[model samples]
Target chain A: MPFPQFLFPNSKFPSQVRNIFLFIRRYFNLLLFLFLQGFSIYLIVHNSRYHNAIFGSITNQLTGKVNEQFSRVEYYFQLKKTNDSLVKANAKLYNKLKADFELPDTTSNIFVDSLKVDSIETYRKYNYYPAKVVYNSVAAQNNYLVLSRGTAQQVRSGMGVIDPNGSVVGVVTDVSKDFAVVMSLLHKDSHIEGMLLKATRKQAHSAGMAWRPISLTFPGYRKVRKWLWETASYQVATVPAYQKV
Target chain B: MNTLVKNIVRFALFILVQVYVLDKIHLHQMVTPYIYFLFILWMPFRMKRTWQMLVAFALGFTLDSFHHNPGFHAAACVLIAYIRPFLVNLLIPQEGADTNYEEPSFKSMGGFLPYFIFTGVLTLIHHGWLFLLEAWQFGNIWYFIFKTLLSTAVSLVLIVVTELLFARKQSFRTNTA
Candidate 1:
């Protein structure tokens, strides 16, 4: 009688449900598109891809900014403790920095002094940049974190971001001149190599929502992936050689 | 602003809001807002089918750009856009009635139920895909199912509340207040 009925000749729903089904049938491609999109979102959420993660750089910038703003109020309360830590750190590193790198005569110093370790790039092994979180969206299937630092700040895509708590946040995905976005560990499109802090020191690609505490998944549970799932504080590390290019 | 400027601003604003405001929420350990899909839901009526699909793809892509996950959101949004025409035609009963009308507003569609159904089904479809893709090999099917249902519920509720609060300009006899 109508376009929908013309499209749905085989569905078995009551008249009311059939009407809806018929309509959906008429637009089957959209449904397929939607389904595939959902599936793709799930893939992004669970799979791993450094060059194409959905929530990498922007998410980092965003969360970094929010945390910074929040820290303002937080700093007010934790000022004493923060200052105390700063003084202790300053006192400890001030002499060490001068002695380590600023040494008048270069001795056989195998290790660089930890005092000059403030910037990530200062170390040859890792590149680092200071950034502010400008935007962060973790509530979606593909959550993103944005940062205020970009090419100007030498913040490249694929660098790992972490909270002070040692928990893995995500990696840098994109960077503009003054802004960068990161994918958070809690994002549906998130995955990272994480090692359990236990004696076994198990490692797996941590994937799951930042929402669900028990959401993280480890692959190859065929033998002992299940056993290694118990508990661990995770960290995000940069994949070198790839991001620099 | 003209319609073009208005729509552009709307798109950018939503993206900004989604990333800056909604993404910061950490409820129980998992993120909650996931409202980037709202862009697809809130689009104006009368847009072309092909354009709508393109917009859906673009919406997902933009969101994907915000994160590092590509193709996933783009795919989901495009699907929803493709299906939108079918949903509207079924709900509106276009039997030589106002075919050229510019929107799927409540007045043209007869009521909120049709609109709700249209939006709700698409929402479910989108969330379901998102959850399953994230699941990959699967640990607990129930958890994924629960996430789909719960997230759908929240998104639908928000849509309903927003419609009610806005008192949109179109008030047809068939539409709900």
Candidate 2:
């Protein structure tokens, strides 16, 4: 090794130092690859454990914008299907409207108007806000749905999401400026309690846990199977934090 | 200038198709076609390896953002990008003989058989790493293997079809450039 004597005139390990530099220069690509791989693994471990605070927020905003735009194109293609579902939901709601029914004549009977009519405010416990699903996937173990509504529209984490027909969709997990991430019911960690209306007399209840074969395949738990199978008609509403089922 | 523009367009097209179209098609829970790695695979051989890895990281990170899995794709992509030059050298021993071929394609890799093998091996490695990181356990080893193999098969088919469709056009453009 013809080492430059001027740079390290008195150094005893100058040749070794030069060799180290040569090795680094020779395999710099491999070093870079390992560094990048380690960075990616770090990101995975960090983001998978808890809500990512730094890069997550920035990437979430960008992905939210792009998905929102892409979903518009998809929404256009599915306009007919969306219109049909909306019509069906409309018909169902229209039949339950107060204007569709009239009180029968009760002239022969004594009328009692002791109950206060303006007490509906006490019974109104929940409010529903409409939002579009900008992105959704059922293929992953931990599936998440992104909604177009976010903090801008008063959407907050821990809020429940429901479809047009009032079926449980998901629960809000993260919120950005113009978008929110919902942990869908198909996720492995999503646990929901489903009540069986037909067994109301018996007080039979079932826990609706998603993606668990033990819950679905248990032979003795016919009630659980029935509730899980009747996903269309049966409704799972989010109970208030203060209330217990 | 033309090659740069062409690669940029290819990058956008690959990301869009992979995220929007291929992701929506739920063929099975185990089989996901990840043909987006073809962007890195098709990168020019003359480009620096460090730059290739960086580009692969960006591509994988972009896909990861959309899928909500932050690092799995990025790790797999970087690994493949790092190994791509070695695979090319092993497969095509002669260097200056095919100097005109700017990128690896059917014609550049000598023939369809070599290209197929090259693509299949890389796809297998990429999918294996991704699915392994995704499952992150050996409890279901069979499940992991099946998922990797099935996804590799699907991705290979899509990649070969894409190459067949666009390889000639790419070679023509490279020649003109």
Candidate 3:
């Protein structure tokens, strides 16, 4: 295996030819490294902002497929925890229904729609379109999530995303027609406005990786109680101040 | 397992862990541990350059696809793979030029310090090139140095810890190529 047959065909031809072949084989590593490094540099230098948009989408499409497969396998491992949360949520909903029925009917025994039939219409400021997480990460300095739904289904950048249990997962950062990327709370650049539930003090904290203490950056306060939860794979902590709905 | 099959499996496992696990860990603003490079570092010492470079490219490209930075990781990987043989020669001259050493672990490398230095220096080089290329436009010399050093430290610690916890002792074998 000193030299492949294709490179050293007719080794019997001449001594000089064999010598050249041997030399090439000896230094082949250097040649290959230079060629590869040049190509890599070309890719880095030629990738303009205009091309990044196109490239980014292409990468997302490719990674989305593979990551979706991985997430499926990971989903099995978390089924018990997910199931537990679902059961708890169902019980809460059941209790709420029971409490509502317990209220005495002031008008009649039959249930009646209570809203006045007015000419005016109502609109919702925020619409939650549930999407499954196709991919998620908690280890990177800048973590991102890939959602199964995308712009085709009304998912867009700046839209809020939450887990099944209603935690502040992240906000949609990029959107393709059929896939979307979310900059998760674990990202270093991620900053969400929050206020302590028990106190009136407002502060801003930069998000850290899961299970790590999130750092408080605003108001220059160093003594704030940093919450560290034994976070799960799919659900991390939700900022109480920013918890809407 | 045969060397070929073992390397293939290692390549896949390293890529998977890098993309899904290590990539998610943001220990600090400056440090991002790239443990996947361990795949290249730990490859059988006797493997040919062509195969090593090819495998390195594939590993880096896979990571590049996940990281969404085309060719960055691949370039760094190729660079390190290119220099690996030279580093082996310089560091382990006692093995002689012809010895086909097994996978580089603490036991195989004779002791902890050689293995540590080998893994650490290679990791530093890889991380240095990676961060430099990534922060090419930043033009802040201090920032680049800080990031490279910090990331190298984190990666070194993780690699050392992983080797200690998972590496199994194997009887040393030597063959002449």
TM for every model, in the order presented, reads 0.60, 0.82, 0.61
Docking class of 2: medium
By summed lDDT, the worst window of 10 consecutive residues in model 1 chain A runs over A227-236
The lowest-lDDT stretch of 10 consecutive residues in candidate 2 chain A is: A105-114
Candidates 1 onward: DockQ, in order? 0.22, 0.52, 0.31
Tell me the lDDT of model 3 at A33.
Answer: 84
Ranking by lDDT: 2, 3, 1
- Candidates 2 and 3, the one with greater TM-score: 2
Instruction: Tell me the tens digit of each residue's lDDT in model 2 across B73-96.
Output: 999999999999888888873655
Candidate 1 residue lDDT tens string, B1-177: 455676787687777666555555555333244667766765666566657777777777776655555666677677777777777777675653334434555555667777778778889888776566556533457777777787788777876776677655643333232
Error of 1 at B174 (Å): 16
lDDT per residue (tens digit) for residues A157-232 in model 2: 8888878777777678777898888877766566666665566568766555554322323455576435554663
lDDT of 3 by residue, A1-245 (tens): 36676755775659887888777878888888888888777766764221246567777787778888888987998899989988976775665564567575342321233364642433333455767777776644346778888778877676767665655676676777677887776654455543233333355444443322233233322332234222322244444323121
Worst 10 residues of 2 chain B by lDDT: B167-176
Show the colliding residue pairs in model 2. Answer: none
Q: How far in Å is the alpha carbon of A117 misplaced in model 3?
A: 28
Taken in order, the candidates have interface RMSDs of 6.3, 4.3, 5.2
lDDT by residue (tens digit), candidate 1, A46-89: 54544333454454445355455654554576678767865865
